[model samples]
Structure formats: structure tokens, C-alpha cells
Target: MSSSGLVQIDGLSPIRKEDRKTSKVMLLFPPEWVPTAPYLALPALTSVLREAGHTVVQRDINIEMYDHFFTMEFLIWVKGRLGMQLKPLQDKEKAGRLTEQEAAQKAVLEEAYAVDVFDLAQRSEDAKLIVRGERFYDAEKLERALNTFREAMQYISAAYYPASLVFYPMESNLGYRPGVSKEVFACLDDEQVNVYRDICNQLVLPSVSKEKPTVIGISIGTQMQLMAGLTFCKMIKESFPDIHVVVGGNVVTRLQEEWAKHERFFTEVFDAAILYEGEHALLWYIEAVNGQRPMESVPNLMYHASGAVQQSKEVYTEKTAALPLPDFEGLPLDHYFVPERIIPYLATRGCYWGRCTFCDHGQGYFDQYRGMTAQHVVEQVTALRDKYQCRHFLFSDESYPPALFKKVSQLLVDRNVGIKWTTLIRFEETLQDQAVWDLAAKAGCCTLYYGMESANERVLNLMDKHAKKSVIQNNLHQAAKAGIWNHVMAFYGFPGETRDEALETRQFVIENQPVIHSVELFYFVAYRHTPMVRNPDKFGITIHKQEEYDLPLDYYYTLNEPVGISCLDAMQLCEEFYKNDFSPWAVRVNSREHVFLYISKFGTNKLPQIYAATKDGATTAEGVSGLVTWPMAIGEGDEGKEGMSRVVSHGVG
Candidate 1:
């Protein structure tokens, strides 16, 4: 870095002077989600191309769209849409078509419009202030600000647009389920209500026009991004027909088989769809586009040709493990949602334990497990800290390699890396090691998310988790005692799961309220391509599909054999249980912003106290599944030591 503290990448070997003269590749991450942190895929891909002597320009339109849309000026545009909805009621009242009760409700809504909700146009400066951290951290103020924001967004969604406009839990008509191209194409044609199209014109087109890149890659990681991404492709193809539009990510990988059936969709929208670990596929696809290689040589790429989808041969390479460290040089780091920029680094690809029946993770392109060496991870961390002046990281892995992270923790401790990081992990026996947990905490591990899945041992075994109820508890206890926050992810509505078993899972969470800082209870999603979906009979369920072509969509209907809990019943029960019984600190599932804010304010150790006070106000457990024996204090004390020792000594077999 220069003396100005600006990031300087001129010395990097990957960025050669001649590469700037080569074809310019623009990688874009679309908008309408949490503005915190650029998704790691773009940076990882950028590194791959730059290392191969390619000029790449990476831009995050997600943050840019947030900056443009979350202004007071935009409030006036929203109010106009809300007014259009209210105009019908006014006309009805003018024509005497409203009854007394209906008039009263109409008047109430008018009053809301006449009040400060409509005055948001004047609060534009305050909106900026609130988002800029004047009111972001304070729970009460943040709630009010978000309520106002949500009210405006919901009104816009109801009045003009057709998308779930929220900071988290995004959904849209352009759904992520496979074979939704026809439906999404209809959305693309809706110019009147399609705010996404407007966004692309306002934000995406200008940049593309300026750079004039030969290849444009869009990363769609979730169902929420599907609509925006497809619209982006459509708009780009319509305006700049020659730019090769490539779309890929985890979601595309999931939909590859079904998407191939709709060849016209690609013919109209994108040039190709790259699958799996997209680094190799994208590089080869770019090369093929540049005439450096034949189209047939490109691996893992699918495109339309001769009115049919043409697919390249599947490529296998350990390139992800050996690729240059992800380059975040061009992203707008300071504009992310969080106070500290959390760079996502991948330590492994695919799951270390890939036996979960309901999971499609580590399948297809990611079937083989690969992990970067511990020394490589250490070097990457040191380089990132020095280059970006960043101290927070979120490890982007299916499940961080347990043995790999152990070595990383030791290296970070020895080198005094001083970087706070978090990642998802399974309930493995290594977590029961007190020394391991302590070393992780010393190396700045703040939170460890465990996929508890279910509290019932039968349900867990049925899912092939290979973890017992007792082991989950012990790991949580040891992690907490070692000064790391424990986030438990509980899922219900599994095949053949009884109502009693679901309730038992809820009860287990209620009992372990002290050591557990947060819980994310989820209803089971029967993803396609998983063992459970492929062979429902093996799990004692019947999948009733309309067609027999093995195409997977997000939602499915199934008959539970011998009267197991239905998905609806499970969802309703979980909703009621969480609303009535779960601790207030335990946020609703997928509320990423709330989790970050909670940790940012209280710190990880105090999370149990924060949540425990909400329900019965107990920081210590009274017989918590034989896992935690005592309450853990922030500093090293006798109680904390005893709790750690007990957890370590009773490690689950």
C-alpha cells in the first residue's frame, strides 16, 4: 500500500501491462439484496483471469443499486406508486361506492399517507444519516428506521413492482426454480412494473457501454438474483448483441440439467451457462470466445447451437485449491453494509463429510473434496490484511474443513494474524477439543455455525448426519466455554419426522438457551438431486411429480408414509414455537443483518446473556443435555475453566 493507505496492485504479477491491451472482461454482481460484502465468486474469478494475463473489471452493482434506491429522492417515486393504488378508493368514494366500514379503512390509509410516512421525501438526509451509522447500531432507532424503510418498500412492491424488496429474505416472480425461463421472460417484458429493467438501464448499461467488454459474466448465487440476472442478460443482449453474456454460480449448477431443455431461453438471454467451480469453465469459455480455443474444448459450458443446447465435456481440475488468492481490489469495500469489511475466503471446496442425504452439496462439479493447505491459507490471510487493511473474514465454504481449520487456527495464533473470522461447520468431534476451540478463539474466531439439523437422533441418523444429539450439545458447550459464539441451525419437516420429534427439537433448543447464543430453525426443503429426493421410498416417502423427467424445482409435494409430519404442519408448528417460546435474541432464519448487528454491538461472549435475559433470564443451564455444566463468563474464571474441562473430558464417542 502507498503512504496514502490506498491499495496498490501495480506490483502484482497477475496484472501485466499487456493484459490491459487484451480483451476487457467485465464481471457484474447484481442488486436488490443485503449491501454488505461483495459475493466472493466475482473476486475469485477475477483472480483466475488476472493470473492468466487477462484484463478484468469487477463491479458490484448490488451496492451501487442500494446507494441509488435508498435515497429520500426515491421516496417520492414510491409515494407516487402508492398514490396510484389509493386513487381507485378515492374514485369509489367520489362515486358513493364505499360503505361506512370501507370508508373508515380508506380514511385510515389516507391518514397514513398524510402523516410522516409520506414525508419521507423530506427525511432523505436523515435516511443517509441512519444508514451511515448515526442510528444503525441502536436497536430501537434501527428498528424504527427499518420499519419505515420496509413500509415504503412493501408499498412499492404492492403498488408498482412485483418483487420482495427487503434487505434480507429476497424473493421475486423471476423465481429460482428450474424451468422458470418462460415465466421470467414474461417478467422481462413487463416494462411498466419491472423496476429491475429500469435498474439495469440506469446502472448496468452505462458501465457496460463505457467498458465495452467482450465478455460479461453474471454471478447468480440464489433464487433472489435469478430475475435480476435474467433481466440483465436480456437487456445486455438487446442493446449490445455482440457481448458474450455468461451466467453461472451455485444456482445455475443446480438448474443445469433442466435449463438445457429450454434452448431458446439461452438463445435469447445468455451466450452460455457455466457450471460447478466456474473458474476453469469460465476461463476456457472466455478463451473460446476470443478464438484461442475451439468451442468444443470449453469444459462445463452449455450454450445453444442449431436450435438445441450444446454442452462441452465435463472438466476436472484442482484449480480452485491452487488458484491465486481472490482479488478484491476493485470492489467498493467501504460501501458494504457492515462497519468492518468482511472478505470471504474459501479454505475448501465441497463438503468434507458429504453423506447428508437431503443435501446436493459436493455433487456433480464439486464431488471431490479439495482444501488449500494451511500454510497457503496463512499466506493468503497475511497478504489480504496487508493489501486491503481488512481484519474481518467470512470463510466461504460448504463446511470449513475441520482438520484444515485446526491447522489454520494454529498458524493464525503463531503468526498473530489478529483477524476475526466465522464459518459454517458440522457437529464433528474436533469441536469437542478444548485446546482446538481455545486456539481458534485466540486466533480471532468469533462465531461457529453448526448444522444441528434435528434434535432427534433418529431423524439425524435418517439424514445421514453421522452426529448424535449428545455430540452437538458437547461441541456447543466447548465452543462457548472457549469464548466463541455458537449458532445452531435446526431444521424440521424432514421425511418421516413426527410432530413429537419436531417439538422435541424445539424443546432441546429451549433447554439449551444459556450457552446457545442464536438458533435458526428451518422447515425442510426437499431439494432435487439429493438422495432423499431421488429415492423417496428409501426414506419412507412418496414424491408425487407431474412428469417423470427428474427435473427439480424448489417446491415439491410428497406423501409422508405412515402419517409422518406434513410440511405445512411442521412449518406452522415451528412458526408458533419460535414466536412464542424461542428467545428474542434468536432471530428468524436468514436474517443476516440482525446477526451481524447483534454481534457488532454486544460482542460474542455477551450474546448468551443478551438472549437468556429475554426468556427466564438465565445465563447458566440447569442440566443442558449433559453438555454444558455451568455458565461461562467473559473473562477466564473458575466457572469457565470447569465448564471447558467438563466439556473436553466428556467428548462424545
Candidate 2:
């Protein structure tokens, strides 16, 4: 290995011409992620491989699956699958051996069978068109289209009964706990509830067969993608034993240690895994497979060899400036559920403010922070704009640094990039100036997502966020004043946060509704690698580990002392806040892309049509309360149009 852990076998003699030849590679992004845009990982890796003279075909299976789900042909096929499922259950019921669960599955299939598949499929197709056309701007029509999608998802769920699959939020449960290795393995082969198996058969395998790529790389970025990504790996390995299967992404990086212990994952599911930054590592691995380099020299790689799993000794980090712009060429951009293409661009690799005790996002990167210059950012933004004709961008940074934020905003304006954008940012004292916000808005900043974990200063300090209440308020006010939509995300509990402190956060958001256009409140999760979980006593919490959860990424925890809100209490508090105070944030359109597009369309933060209609037929404005929202609850005696209008809306923050 070289000093930097890059493969150093160029001087070595090649074994054979076939072994030394360049290989065709296929990169697959698995499902259960938001299908609004192409994830940056595939394109980022694809650019490197293609630049290296290898033929690369990148597939966004997540968006492809969603696109296929609402089609007439796919829905008709789902109807047949549902009938097949019903037959087995009906046979069991007739034999008087059906269990309660089986009977419930039978009922689901029966109800699904009763629906007119042809009519449902037509509506489903129309739903797809509405989201991808001018009708998306009509909130009412878009809402109905979204409802049709949910109905189609419900119909498909019957085929894979007990597996809850959703569209917008990209949540899917395959009736198996993903954290446990045994269950995860069992889920891969399960013909009943593992919906991904059918998805692989219909979508992934045929593509693999046609492309016949020598190597396949699957990116599993989130926990939700784990089951689906792994299923794709296993199925592809089974069908094409000669093809090399590799997995990588944020989730893989976080669980690298645990994955080392699971020998079957390397031997059966995937041939190798990449950790941390994957660009250089993957290129090195491909060279190794072609016999031009030794496998051990590939940095950030782990593979099964000689009856054991081994990780490369030295880890390599990417030079942010050296990497090429993400290649979005092969992805089906128009298939995404947006009227216009919205590209996701990353200028920074890791969090600059990396001290938050609750965050494990930093663990995904070997280096905590590396960012490109403001001029470089604007240059690439313009390049992407010209190449893809996409004017909306999602700056998928961990947190936009205040200095870089100001510089980039000014550069965008100076260069006249003319692209609408949104990104997550921290509330910085340096960003108190109104000119910064105005410049950002003028540079086409449509929205900003703030990780304002708590409004209480003491709670913020406990989390090591150190953001002042004054700064938070000032940031929101200025951003709003500049016509930018501010979406604030805060959690209910930290280890030592009291009930009153949690209430303080709730009250702060309620009082600042005019400035905070949207809100998301979550209960704290003790990720296994978070600073708080690592030093439990220091954070006044005791981490709980379950033996069966061998592949665990997070853990349950308890307060070390009886002085703060317990985990259960945090959950209850979040529920209470959603029930009582979520009215103002419950929007007709919940997807971030949709909201960003709306803000860009209206050219203002105040969108009355986007809000839920009040019981008195008024739009629920900021500071409004007790109004029925999109996901309104149904009362015992309520029915018909009035009841439907009273339902509250639920969506991502």
C-alpha cells in the first residue's frame, strides 16, 4: 500500500490481459429514500469511474420503483400478486388452520381484490402526471393526487401484507427488525412480506441482466434503505455469481465495526464494502479486481479473504476540491415527482459545527469538515444549471458555515447564477446582520432548515450546540424578513433537559410562528456512536443494549437520574405538541421539494394557499391555531366532506 493507502501495484506485472482489462460497472441506489431527486452518492462515484475510462451505468432504483408503482402495468401486476396471496390465505382459512395474523392478511387481500384495478391504475397514472406537471402548483389537485398515491400504496401493501410501505417520507417496514442480523437475513429470502424481493425481480434484476456489468455497487445511505439494499445485493449475487457486489454509504460507514463481525454479510450478501468517502476507495477496488493492484491496498475497503474479514490498514479521505461535479446524466431526472428538475448539490463534506452531543452524522466522515470555495460553488452551480437546465438546487450540506454561507450567497448574486436553493444551517451570532439574509434571499435562497434543537439556552448548552436564544430569534426574524421560509427542527428531550425546558421550546416556536414558517419536533434517539452514548454518565443517561440487535446503529436509553424527561416522556411530549400545536406547520403540500417549489413560485414566504383550510373556510395562517389540517383526525360521529376537511396534515420537516 502507498502512504495514503491508495493501491500501488502499477509497477507490478499483470497476471493476464483479461484480468488487467477495464471492467464495466453498474451502480445501484436502492429504495426507501425520498424519490424527489437523485441522491448525490451514485453520481459522485459515477463521475470518478467514468473519468477513469470505465463504462458506468448508474441507476436510481428508488425513484424508478416509485415511478413504476403508480403505472397501469405495475398496478395490474400487483393485482395478480394480491390474488395469489389471497388464494393461499383462503385455502388456509377453508382448512380452518388460519392464525389471527393470517386471517388479517386474508382480509387485506380480499379488500384489495374488491377494488377495480383498472380504475385505480388510471387514477394512479394521473397522480403521477399531476405531480410532474403544472397541476402540482394547485395545492388542492396535488393533495388529491397524493391521496391517490397513498391509495395505490395501500393496494400494493396488501400483496406484501404486514409490510407498511409509504411514498413521501420513504418509510417501509418488511415485518422484520432491521437492527438484528438474524431477522435481516431472514427477511431477504422471505417471499411473503419482503416487498423488496418483488421490487428486485421486477426492476433491478432485468437491468442487471441486460447491462451485464462486471461489478455492482449499491449505496445504502439510511437505515430505511438497509433491508432493501441488502436484499438487492443478495438477489443479485444469487442470480449473477460472477458479478462483484459491494455496499457503501453513511449507514455502512457507521456500522463498519459491526459489519466486520458478520461474516455472512461479506460471504453471502456482498463481496466487499466501502466505508467513509467512497470515490477513491471504489476506484482502487475496481483496479484490484482487474488484477492491476492488490486488494489490501484499497483504502476504506473491507472484504472476506482467507476465512476472515479484513479492513484496509490506512483510511483515505477525499480532497473536496479535487472531486468532479456530480454526474446526473444516466438518472431518470424527469421521472422524479417534481414538475421541474431539482438537483442536489453538496459543497461541504462534514459538519463544521461538529460538537452536538446528539449527532452521529459526523461519524460517516473520516474528516469532520472540508468545503469548496464560494467561487467554485457558484461555478459548479452554473455549470449544472446550463448542463441540466435545472434552476432549483438543494444544498445537501450538514450545516452551511456562516462565513461560507455569506460568501456563497454574495457570489451567487454577483455571478447571477439565478438558481433557487435551500440548505440546512446553524444559527450563528455572526449571521445577525440583516444584509446577509437579504443577500441570501436576493441570491435565490427560497428556504432554510435550522437544527434549532432547543430554544432554551441551557438545553442548547447541554447539547453542546451553544446557540443563544437571541441569535436563534434574530436568525429566524431576519430570514423571514428577507422572504425566505424558515423551517425549524427541534427535539423534545436531551439527557438533562427538564419538562419546563421542553415546554419552553414549544412556547418559543408558538410565539415565533410569523418567522418560523414550518416546524418539526422529534424525540431524542441515542445513536450508538453519538457523543452522549459514548459517555453515558457524563450525559446522565444509561445506554441499553439488546444482545439480538447485533447490527444496531442506535440504542434505547434511560436517564441516570430522576431529574429530567424520560424517553417515554419525550415521546409523549412530541405527540402532545403535534396534536395541539402542529396546525400552523401542517401544510397542504408536505414534501420539502414541493414547499421549496411553492416558495420559489410565489416569490415570498407567505403562501396562504399552501396552508390547510380552517373549519370556517379560512386559510390557516401563521399564528393560527385549532384549525383542521391535511391529516385531520376523524371524530366518532364525523363523516363526509366536513370530516375530511377536519383531518390534520402530517409531513416531514
Candidate 3:
């Protein structure tokens, strides 16, 4: 791939869409999408696909689509359409049930699921609402809405199309962090949008060539994953109609229920939708499309054919070791902005403490705490480093328990590969062990992102996130001493968060400033599949829903006592972020598991001197807010000539 993301060599199109019997797949990520990551169906899906002896392509579109002119205008428009509140599918006993919670969830489902008939009419003029998102959705209408969005974006600004990868030019300049986040796409100007649109459109239609493989596979890791998939499917359908397009990842499963309803979209854009982990599923799709295997037994597959949608048998429980280590070689290894791969490795899936009431990951015993052989992990690392010469890695594992850390501590030391890495580790003194610390530092573990959920005891219990504040603090101090960058994820605005407790969070940050490198604050949004969403009524929490999309603030909780701030105070919270150059991070601890000694700060611009100033100290919060405008929005102009001096850039990469 050229540094410009344009193939300087002639006719480097991907594998053709024919010869479906061969094991080839194209994974796609969507453009200008939201969500840090999506439909994380990859780890499992990739394994499923690979298990079937098929080639899989991982498309990192979450970062890719942002390369386009993803204007704040689009975001604001989406916000206006979806509203600021979330519809967590709560208050119902089941996901689709219509009990009180279900009723509320249903109300939202009705709205979001349905195409804005008026908008559709406005866009298409004569096109009828083929699939209504009403109680009885016509599959035809669903297709129309999707086609409409696609057509609109394609036509309005498809000319400038050169920036398919937003960071393509500035990639090497980035530090060890991941690609510019979705948030970075905000405040896009007309010039940036036109350039980005042109670049993206250019990549959309790959010129066919002999080098084009028979089939291509793309992986959707974030919302952009979906967007990328959307474009790839369309492009392939238009350019290489014979190629079978297959799609799968985590997000697909969550919305499978809705997606399953929209058959026309799949029939037109893709051949199959693999909702389950596809390590083996890709093979199934290949075999099925290529006449290699039967679909009856292909677990977790959604296919559209003969004007009907066919879903394969569902399979959940699978052995971790049985899965492949993930094929990272095919990716542009050197293209990784991080010096090292920032390799998102995981020791295992599933949290041992999978009792978080609000986490979708806790459902169906999906993420049961399971450990991989430390050797197996090291072996993968060895392979990546030897092949890609990666010097740093970032473990994307949601949790790395003490035992797993202890078990690998020595192996990493002895293996002597001398790589640096970071993982999401629980707050435990075990990390303080000299051997562990020494090995980690030597192994390239420079930072640890710890999740100290909250300072509110009641909220912790409610969320089932057990961590004592005292222990968390101690862990941070020890981690700081251990020479690790301690970025703590402190959450506020959960149930039972009193103003006093909220203030306590601030106090903790101020007091532990030296120990903690950075802090992050978050308002709780009940995950789609978590117990909080499953049984919201039992806890007296109500969630409002919106159609089309959701955001962080859209989710809110009601407690016996209103703690911290309600959703209504979301602005006040903004007031805090905008007024202070403090870079808007949070910190927390509770009675359950502690997650101190680490934190991940979102990289923003450097605010004015927050250390010496206050909202009113020789300035108003408005004056200090890096975002000069309303609601702390860091406008595009804020990012000045070389790199804005205002947006705080300090963060854990």
C-alpha cells in the first residue's frame, strides 16, 4: 500500500468476488462512525473464520472512515434525530419483551427501527416506504432507508475523495496511540471534508486487476467497521457483482435482531452476515458460497438468499485455546502509528467478575474469565515481533487478573524479548512485586490503564464493581513508584452518586495528583446486553430510548437518592470540563475489586494552565473551556497551525 493509501503500482485490486468455494473473505469498517469499538465480533469471529481455513481481512475502519470529512454537522444532525438520551432496552425482562421496560425499549425500537418515512420520501421523492420501522416493519422499507443513507452520503460530497484513511499522511507522526478517535472528527471544515471525501471515494472503487484475489476479507472493529463494510459491499456489488460478500463482528450480533429484519439490505449489499465469531464461519460461508460445506451446521450465520433470510444454528461456549492467535501479519504492520503494534492483545476473554449490572459483556456468561497459556500469548507476541518488529503492545483485554499476571511475569522476564507493553490490569499489589514490575518494564509495559469505577460505595454495589477506595489509592501509589504510567478511569454519575461523593472524586484526584498520571470521567450507559438492561425495573431505573443512534449522555440512572448529577446536569458536567484545562478525566474506588494503578486519558489539546486557574479564578469556566463555544465543544479552529496548543494531548497511548 502506498503511503498515500493509493496504489502507485497499477491494477492492485483485491481478489475477485468469484470462486466462492475458495476460503476468502472481505471484512469492512464503516466511515465517520461512532463508538470506540463495535461488534467486537472479531476475536471470536476471526477465529471461527480462520478455523475454517479461510483468509480473513481485518478492516480497521473505525479509524479509517474518520479520514473523511466527518463534520460535527453530521453529528449534530444525528443528535437532533436521536436525541441526547439513550434507550438502554431496560425495564423489560427480555430484550424484545414489551413489559414496562420492554415497553419503553419498544417505544424506542419503534422509532429507531423505522425509517423516517418523511425523510425517505424527501430524499427519494418517488420511492415508496418499502420497509416501515413500525410495529410491523416491511423489509422493503428497511432496504429503502439504508439505500437512502448510502445514496445521500455518496452524492452530496463524493467528489473530493482522496482521504480514505484520515491519518494516511500524518500516520508516522502519531505517537504510540491508536488512530485519531471518532471524537477527533468533530468540527470538520468544508475544506477538510472535501479532501477527505475525495480520498475516501477513490478507495471505494478499487480498479480491477489480475492481482485482485478471488475474495477479500475485512474486519469491522468499530462503528467505522460497519460503515466500511457498507461501502465495501456496495463497491464490490457494483464493481465485482459475482464476489460473495460476507459480514460479521460483535456489533452485528447486538443489532442482529434488527438486521435480521432487514433482508433487502443484505441481499443487495452482501451475500452473508456472520453474526457469530467467524474463525470458522468464514470457511462455512466460503464453502457454502463456493459449494464446499453445508450451512445447516455453520454456527452464528445470517444469510440472505432466494428472497429469504436464513440464520444458522447458534453456538456460544467455545474453548479459548481452540481459537487462533489472530492473523496480524496481513495488516500493514509498519502502518501502525504506534512504534510497537500497540498490539491489542488479550490474555483471555470474559471477566471473572462478570456481575456488572450494566455491562453487556456480562450476559449469557459470554465473557467468562478464562486464561490462555502464558506461553501461547508469548508465542503470539514472539511471532508478531519477529515478523513485524513490534517494540510496543497494548493488551485490549478488558481484564487481566492477578493469577494470569503472576503466571506470565517470569516467563516474560526469561524469554528476554525486551518488548514494552500495557494491559488492562486489576488493582492488585501483586503488580508491585519487583519481579513483575521488572519484567513488565523490560517487556515494554510502559503504562497500565486501571478502572477505578467510582468513589460512591452504593453505586459500586449497584454496578457490582467491587473495589475499595483505600486499596485503589494504595495500588496507584505503588504503581507510580513502580515506574508505570498510572492512568485511572474514574466514573461518576452512576446510581447512588451523591454530590458529596462526586466532590470526593475531585478531592481524590487533587490529593493523588502525583500518583495518578491522568483521570477519566464517564456517565453510565446501560450496555445493550447487560443485566441492568435485562432487569432495569427491579432497580427502579428507567431508560429512555431513541431511534437511529445512541450516545454516552443518552443513558441515565435514577437512584433512591440523586447522586453526583442527573442527566439534566450533563451541561453542568460540561461546565466543569470546558472551564478547566484539567483535561476532563475521572477517578474512583469502591468496596469490590479495585482498579487503581492505571488509567487511560483521552488525548485532547493542552488547555490553558488549569493548575493555577479556576472557572472563576481570573477567568470564568467559559474562558478556560478549550472549546470557545457552547457545551465545551473543541471546535476545528481549536486545532491550530502545527497542533493546537489548547487541546490536551497528554494521554496513555
The top-ranked prediction according to TM-score is: 2
Cα lDDT tens digits for candidate 1, 1-653: 32323231211122234543357899988764456666777888888788777789998888877666666666566666557657877898999898775576466446545645446544533554565564566544544554555555554454443344654333334222324454666777676456778789888999999999999999876545667888899899999999999998766777777778877668888989887667757777787787666777666678887878987555434445467888998899987655566677776766678777877644333446677889998899889988999887777566777788799999999998888877777788766778888888888888776667789999888888878888888888888888777766666788788889988998898888777776656677666667777788788767666554333444465765666788777678766755566534433212343454456455566633222232455332221111111121110101011111111100000
Per-prediction TM-score to the true structure, in the order listed: 0.83, 0.92, 0.63
Ranking by TM-score: 2, 1, 3
* Pick by lDDT: 1 or 3, better one: 1
Residue 192 of model 2 has an lDDT of 86
Positional deviation of 2 in candidate 2, in angstroms?
A: 18
- For residues 414-434, write the lDDT of model 2, one tens digit per residue: 888899998878899999999
Q: Write the per-residue lDDT of candidate 3 for residues 1-653, one digit (tens) a residue.
A: 32312211111112334633445554544443321122233434555565555666655444344322233334234333333222443333355554564455345434543434345336433221221113112223433443443443433222222122221111111111112223222312223223332333445445223224445544433232343455456556666777766665444555556566666557666667665344555655566566555665565567775678877544434456766655554444433212123344655665555555655532222224676888888887777667656555555565567776766656777888666666666665445555565555555556666656666556667667776677677777766666666665554555446666766766777677677655555445544555665576766567655442422212334554443466445445635743463433221110000111111111211222222233554433222211212232111110110011011111000
In angstroms, give how far residue 217 of model 1 lies from its true place. Answer: 0.6
lDDT of 2: 0.81
TM-score of 3: 0.63
Poorest lDDT segment (10 consecutive residues) of candidate 3:
636-645
Best by lDDT: 2
Where in model 3 is the C-alpha error above 4 Å?
Answer: 1-21, 29-200, 207-216, 316-318, 339-341, 362-367, 429-439, 546-564, 581-653
True-vs-predicted CA distance for residue 403, candidate 2, Å: 0.9
Clash statistics: count for each candidate: 0, 7, 104
